[model samples]
Every structure is written in C-alpha cells, then in structure tokens.
Target: MTRSSIRTSLLALCAAAVCTVASAKLPAPSPEAAAKAAEAAAKAAWAGKVDNYKLCLSQDKVAAHYRKTTPSANPAAAGGAACADPGPFAYTPPAAKPAEAAGAHSPPGTASSPPSTQVPAAAAAPASKS
Candidate 1:
C-alpha cells in the first residue's frame, strides 16, 4: 500500500481510540438518570416477587403437602405452605392442552389386533443358580 494510505489508516485508528477513552471518562449518571434506574430496578424486583407469588398460589398441592409435613415449631414454612400464597386477588386459570383423538392412538392395520396376555415360558421360571 502507499504511504499516504497507511498514514490515513493510522490516523483513523487513533481517532477511534481517543473517542473511546473520552467516553470512558464520562461523569457519573445525573440524579434523574439515577432515579429512573432505581425505579426500573424496583419494578423488576416487584415483578419477580409477583411471579413467585403467582407460582406459590398455583401450587396448592405443594402448599398442602408442606403444611402436612412441617411441624408446628418452625412457623416460617407457612410462606409457601399453609396460608401465605396470595389473598383477595384475581386468578386466571391456565389454558388447557388439546386432547389427542382416539383414532390417532394406533395404526389402522394394527388397531384390531388383540393384546398378548400370556407370559413367556422362560420368563415364568425362576433364575437358576450358576
């Protein structure tokens, strides 16, 4: 390559490096930016708790099982157990999966065959000693 072209490339690289360093030296976030970030973090934390709350509510059987097993001494187990799910809240039931049709269960040619009910003679005998 020509000397002029090499010089131009080196200058371009130096400019990019300077720009990156200047950006890295930027001042800390403004008060408004900090406040906005704090608010967003609070919302995220609340969302996580809300999700866990919903999960706890949906796990009625788990809560019941814990309540059944947990002793009366350690009372903290009641969070996901006895009565700490959610209260006075609207609950939307989960959507149901579509059921497979009865005809789709077996191949057409084998659908009418009777199932084998007899045990094999070898399997019927107990294992012999070596």
Candidate 2:
C-alpha cells in the first residue's frame, strides 16, 4: 500500500480504539430509563393490536351491511357483520337476592351484624329429659 493509505489506516484504528474506550467508560442506563423504554415498547405493541381489531370489526360491519341490503348478494363477497370480541374479561352475575344486593352496596369497614336468635341453656335439655 502507499504511505498515505498506511497512515490513514493506522489513524482509523486509533480512532476506533478511542471510541471503544470512551463508550466503555459511560454509565449504564438508569432503571427509570429502562422502565420508560419497556413502557414505550408495550404501548406500541398495544396500538398495533388495536389497529388490527378496528380493521377487522370494520370489515365485518361492511360485510353485514352489504348482506342486509342485498339479500341475494354472494356470501363470499359480503363479509359478515360480526364484531371482533372486546375480550372475555367482563362478567355478569345472576340477579342478587334482596338481602345480598343490599349488602353489596354498603361501604367497606362496616360489617353487617349476624341474625339475632335465642338459644336454650345446656342444662335446659337435661331438665326437660328428667
């Protein structure tokens, strides 16, 4: 190689070594920074999922509408109007009894009292037997 080329190569090697040493001396990312990065990644992923869901639901609605307006329209051509599931996390219970419903609406730290009833003494049973 020419003298100039050799000189340039050596300079390049020295620059790379300097950069490596400088980077190695740098501190690692803080916990807060790492958490923010993770959160950003999650949000991006969630946004993508939401976009897909919206597109799917819209397609179904269009298909259903077309099928409704034109009964004779081809089934393959008309996408069904069924919406994508929101999720299985929601729930509904059977109608609560009056007593149970009332308790559910009460504030916490306020426990209801048990039913009051009278009971005979233990000796009462033996007295009755005799």
Candidate 3:
C-alpha cells in the first residue's frame, strides 16, 4: 500500500459515498411537519428582514457619525434615502379549511342533483358530408 495508491483508494471511497448520498431519497414530510417547516421558513425570512433593517440602521449611524466628524467639501450633498425599518416579526399560519368547507364533498344530508338533461354540443352538431 504505497502513499499514492492509498490516497487514490480514499478518493474513490469518498466519491462513492458522495454519489450514494446524492441519490438517496428522503421520505415525504407529514402534514404537521410540512406546516412546521413552512412556519420555520416564514420566521427565517422575517429574521433576514430584521437583520437587514438592523444593518441598515447601523450603516446609517456610521455614515451620520462620519459626516459629523469629517468636514466634506460639499455639505449639502449628504442627503440619501432613509433607512427602512422592519417593525416587527409576525407569522400567521394560513387558515385551514375543514373538509366540508373546502368543498371536498356535497353538504351533509342533501341529495346530489340529477344529471343535466341537455345534450352535449358535439353530439348535437350535424355530421359533415366529407
């Protein structure tokens, strides 16, 4: 087992492991799990917005401090867009409709209406001579 051969063997093993991992299929998440994941994603997005807002505020503060301390040739040109603040984090999960309310099935006790009596257009049309 020379050094080069051992390194080659290790590389091959690593490649095989990577390929195996890449091809693996994870089981689908349950409904509850999916809902949680969605909520987590929303929270993460809100967190990102909050982070950006904080960064913007810090940058603005820094810029203001720099302007106050340093004399610039043009003082009037210091105007820039105001920093936007992401006020708060609010995650409202989408309202779930009950099976009946979602129109999954006809209302509880009511009988289904009879089939339509009108003939379909295709069948009613006159046949072509050709």
TM-score of each: 0.33, 0.37, 0.59
> On a 0 to 100 scale, what is the lDDT of residue 128 in model 3?
89
* Candidate numbers sorted by TM-score from highest down: 3, 2, 1
Candidate 2 local lDDT, residue 80: 43
Candidate 1: 10-residue stretch with minimal lDDT: 83-92
lDDT of each: 0.67, 0.69, 0.84
Best by TM-score: 3
- By lDDT, the best candidate is 3
lDDT (Cα, 0-100) at 109 in candidate 3: 65
Candidate 3, residues 98-129: lDDT per residue as tens digits? 98898888755665865564887768786888
Could you tell me the TM-score of candidate 3? Answer: 0.59
> Which parts of model 1 have CA positions greater than 4 angstroms off?
1-23, 61-130
Q: Candidate 3 at residue 108, lDDT?
A: 53
For candidate 1, write residues 1-95 as lDDT tens digits.
99999999999999999999888866899867876787677667667767887776668666667767877635565554442433333433334
Worst 10 residues of 2 by lDDT: 87-96
